[model samples]
Target chain A: MPIGDAPPLVRPIVGRANRPAITSHRGRARWERLAPYLLIAPAVLVIVLFRLWPLLLGVNFSFTGDGDRNGTPVGLDNYTDLWNDPVFRIALRNVGLLVLLLPVAVAIPGLLATFIFLRVPGNRLYRTVYFFPAVLSPVIIGSIFNLLLAYDGPLNELLQTAGLGSVDWLGDPKVAIFTVVGVHIWATFGMALVVFLAGFATLDTTLLDAARSDGASLPQVIWHVIVPGLSRTIQFVFVTTMIGMLTSMFGLLYVMTSGGPGGSTYLPEYYIWIQQGQMNRPALASAASTVLFLVMLVVGLAQIGLLRKAGRED
Target chain B: MRELRVTKWVAAVPMMAIALATIYPLIFTLNVALKTRHEYILDRFSLTESLRWDNLGAAWTSGGISRYFINSLIVVGFAVALLLLFGSMAGFALSHLRFRGSRTLFLACLAALFIPFQVIMVPLARTMADTGLMDTYPGLILAYVAQFLPFTIYLMASYYNGIPAEIVDAARIDGNGPFGVYRRIMVPLGAPALLSVGILDALFCWNDVLIALLMMPSAQHRTLMIGVTSLRGQYSSDIPTFSAGVLIAAVPVLAVYLFFQRQIAEAVTAGSMKG
Candidate 1:
């Protein structure tokens, strides 16, 4: 039978029918059939109990004040307060900076991968060295950078020696967000580069060779041939990196600046954490979380829409 | 040949520049870690004559990094184990079994992939506190497993798709149970994916700070990252000591990456593409 013509429901039963007479020995077959689910049960239970339960509880907490003010029901008052809160506005601006930097994160890795795939020598060594930071803990990266960028640290010392005067890196309100962004780009670019490299590997090499022989320049080949081919990888990296930028900014921000220099570095994730952990305003945290979730949902849907459009064009 | 060499050189310069830019800060940090407090103030980047083993020793002993290192290992070990076992099994079922709700479950798994952990951090922390699992190893492990399982399962399932169904059929004909077939056939066949997942998951769990920060708040329960953070305070100028603590925290992870550099690159490449 043709592969696509076969009924999907019949295939598994036929496969199961070939199993041994362990079933004829009474309880063995039933247990055998249920074994896979049994094996996977712990994972399912963990996700449900830990992930799903908390998600539901967060929604519930966003509506009520269960964990705030003696477990009282505050309805949507928390969200009302959040809507007018200036810190939330600052948090939104910080998130906007992150979103604006997304293209840089995607483009740098994409270009690097393209070059590596074009027979760049020592590419393996380059890849390894570049990806090294991705393996380090964000906390470690933040701490190291904090030390290096402090007013009395080496970066400013070098600047002073060069007669440019010292620039505040982590302490200045104007530059703290950029410092965090620079560190983030360094820590995350490697994996995105690797992913792009992988995507490039799947491209048809013959087409590249053909393009080259036809007098296509490297830039032309990349712009025409490689870019189109690696669109899926680009989309995947874009979405995941955007999600990381949205969520994982907390560690670096917390360790490096702690939203300091008058809260200029405060992202929504950091703002929510402070509200919940330090301020003991669980309801406001929930409200902020709800807003963050909505923002993520909107971005996610837009990404999906864009990907689908790209898929259709391809 | 000259043109080709020129092209290669041009391509390499940018890569090298980017690599150097990325690596310079780390090299600077290493230099700072070796300096004494006096040297730190005098010349943060310059090499110091007072490079003391005592600094790292003190960080290890006094900074409480040794305990945190052990704690990280235990948590990563258990979490990776659970991910491998349960993740691969779910992968097998989704690929081979034609049970009711299998498709729905698979889609659920996919949806879980997009949900960022920050969205659930507050509620998850509350749940942990309620369950009396705060500041404990098992609590952190359980949370890590939940966070990582979706991606792991998706990866293993895609890898399993590449296996020939005839092997599974042949095993079934030989009277192997579903568990037996999985154990004998699928496990060995899926070894590459499992190894890849194990390495990635282990690295993630080892390097994780946020969950460890929120879930394990006690000083005794803090991970290496937390230990390093605690070294920094308002009035203290313990740069060398803090840098030492940072170095101590990073050594294992950097060492592991260097040792398994090729496997990790390949695994990351494979996971991103397939996943």
Candidate 2:
């Protein structure tokens, strides 16, 4: 039988229960059949109990009340509170900002990966230096930037020496989110660049050579040849980068801004942390978590759909 | 040809500039770490006249970083070990064994990869608390395992799939059972994948703040990353000491990144390319 057509749980149990007859060849054959399930049992158990089950439980919990009305079902109230809360609104808006900034984030790595793919001078050193920060914790990165972006810090000092005005990098509300996002891009673009380089590794160099032989300009070659060739990688980076923006910048916001400068740098993950951990509003945080989950789900589905359509065109 | 050459040089300029930008912060932090608080206040831009070993010494001995560093080490070590063992077991079984619901289980694992920890963290925390595992080392280790196991299994499965089944058949023909093949043959064959995945998982567990924060709530249980965060508030006015603390938290990661940089990139791209 094909893997997809495997029978349900009954056969596995039947095989296991026959172990008392182990002296028989039939029992030994049954053991052979049960080995794969036995091997996978622990991983399956952990993933189901912790990862998958909690997802369902969290969505169920989101509709309940927090605090004095704890564990009591209050349908849609938590979500309404989330929608009305201004901090959560800013978090949602910042998610939108991340969506808008996604292209720039992806493009930076894509372009650099292309250059490195072409083996630019000092490409190896550039890759090493760039990827170093990606391995560092965001807390360390944030703390380091905390010094560099301080009002009288080295960056501002350099700006002052350049005869330019020193801007408040983390203190100004309008600028704090962008500043954090910029640091995030700095820290993470190397990851995407590595992914892009991996994609470039699979590209047929003959296509690039063909385009070059046709005297195509750099931009034309990129647009007509590389873009089409690496569409999947581009889409992969887009989704993963957006997911990183949404879910992984918590440490940066936590240490660098603490969702401050008037609560301006709150992403969904940080908002969830604050509501659940600091604010003691787990239900409300669950609602926000649900929204974040939905956003990711929609993004994932749309990309898969787009990938399918793109594949069809091919 | 001339145009391409010109473009390459143009690209080289920014690439070099970016490389400087990338390396500058750590250099700046190192310089700051080497300064005394007095010197840092006097001239943050100036190079330290002497390496102030006292700052690093104070940070390590008294800043609670040593405790947090041990906590992270224990949790990440056990977590990566568990992930590799469980991941390789499932990968071997799934790739080579014929079993019921195997495809469904594999798909389920794949589906679980999409559920990032943030989505389930609230309930997962409650689950941890309910089981009396919260705020404990094993609790945190289990959490890390749950978080990274799917990715680990996926990569291991993909890697093992490349091994010809005839070798497995030969091993079986040599009177080895499934567990025997796994122990005597598969584990050896899966070493490279296990190394890549283990390094990535170690980095994830070590560098994580949010999961560590949620799972280990007490001050004594903080991971190194958490220790670094606490350093910010504790040493806010003491820039040199804070820089030293940051360096202490960062140095091991720096060491790991330097040593295993290739494996890390390989693991990261392994997931992407397979997808």
Candidate 3:
């Protein structure tokens, strides 16, 4: 008879409580069956309790109230408040600006990797020197730039020497966001260069030779051959670079601008931080967090999906 | 070929300029750090005549960077250790073991990787407070682990994918259970991956301001990066000492870069390639 077909009166005989079943071969078999879960339990617990659970809780909490109305479900008041907030508006606008600037960010490293792949003089050394800044914390980078971009700092000194007027890099509202973004690019382009080099390692050099043999100009060879060859890597870089701009600039903003000078440099991340950390408005911050999460999900997943489809076609 | 040679040489000029631009800020900071406050104010552009080390001492002691430095070292140390232990176990199971819910658990991990810390910062803080862990070292360390474990596990799993299954099977036949096989085989085999991933995770924990800022609210609890920012406020007029404080925070990373540049680059590329 099958195990489940046994009568209720005899169920105890087949159940785990049976003495021989607990002590003999089947008990060892049970350990074997559950071993993987046992090994993965700590990781599962940590991730679920801290990362995933909090993410769900944060979304749910956004719908609730803050301060006097705490724990009471306010039903989207916080989100509407976020919508009406001007700093949040500027933050979203800056995100758009970052999206527009993404291509230039992706291209610089691509060209650099191409040069390095062609084995330029000191290419090896250049790779190390270029990559050095990418290892340091953004806080450190921001602090260093705070000095460099000081109104009377060395950058202005260099400009004055070159017969140009001093530009207040971090002080002027119109210039601060771009200046911070430029510093971020300077600080990060190296990692992308390394990724591109990794892509270059898999490139079909014979095709480059073929293009050059056909008297194809350098730009034409790059545009037609290398671009198509490295499409997947390019797509990866595009998505990662955009996400980096969204989430990782908090240190830079916090250290350099603190969302000041008319709040021109307020990215979504900085706004979320200000709302939660300084303003004590956790519900509103949760709303911003939800919005940011959705933004990232839409942008990130869309790219990965779009790129996978393109990759399949190619 | 001759024209190509000419163009490459022309390219070197801009490359050289870019390289200088890349390295100039650090060098400038070093120079400013070495100068006296008077010397820095008098002519910030000029190189220091003498190697002044007092500013470093001042930054370390008075700026409280030394205390913060120790705090960072302890927190990052614990966090990286815990992450490696948990991440490798999960990686080994997901890659090698046949079990129910394994795919879902792996997918759960991958999902966590994309939920950047800012998204859950508010609720995470509440969780910590609810558990009475906020501002504690373990609290901050646990936060770092949760924030980074998904990426660590993904890298480890990918690394383990390269290890053939025959060794694991042989180990099983030799009476090594799942934990035993992982301990003796996978952990040793995954050393290079672990090192690369460990260094990256350590850097993230050390470099992160948002998580550290949110999780550790008290001044004494500040990480080195937060300490660097606080010193920035207190020492704004005193450029040399401030530069010294910045250098104190940055020197460890610079040393790591000098030594493990290849590993760091490889780890980053590894993630990108898999993507």
- Tell me the DockQ of each model, to 2 decimals: 0.55, 0.61, 0.54
Q: Candidate 1 — which pairs collide?
A: A20-B175
Residue B107 error for model 1, in Å? Answer: 1.4
Clashing pairs in 3: none
Candidate that beats the other on DockQ, 1 or 3, i.e. the better one:
1
| lDDT value, residue B5 of candidate 2 | 75
TM-scores of chain A across the candidates, in order, are 0.88, 0.91, 0.90
lDDT of 3 at B7: 72
Task: Mark the 10 consecutive residues where model 2 chain B has the least summed lDDT.
Answer: B168-177
Best by TM-score: 2
| Candidate 1 CAPRI assessment class | medium
By DockQ, who's the top model here?
2
lDDT of each: 0.80, 0.89, 0.89
Task: Please give the distance, in angstroms, between residue A79's alpha carbon in candidate 3 and its true position after superposition.
Answer: 1.8
In the range B1-275, model 2's lDDT, one tens digit per residue, is 67887899899999999999999999999999999889998898789988998899888878888898889899999999999999999998888887768888999999999898889999999999999999999999999999999999999999999999788878776667788889998899889888989999999999998999999889998998998888877887899988999999889889988999999999999989876
- Can you give the TM-score per candidate against the true fold? 0.92, 0.96, 0.95
What are the per-residue Cα lDDT tens digits for candidate 1 across A1-314? 12222223212332345665445444654565566567667767877787776777787788776343646777888888887877788888887887788889899888888778866888877888889899988898998888778798767877988999898998899999999988998998998998888888789988887887787777788778887877778888888888888888788998898988788998888888898889887767877887898898888678768877976785
Error of model 2, residue B96, in angstroms: 1.1
lDDT for position B12 in model 1: 95
Per-residue lDDT for B60 in model 3?
Answer: 97
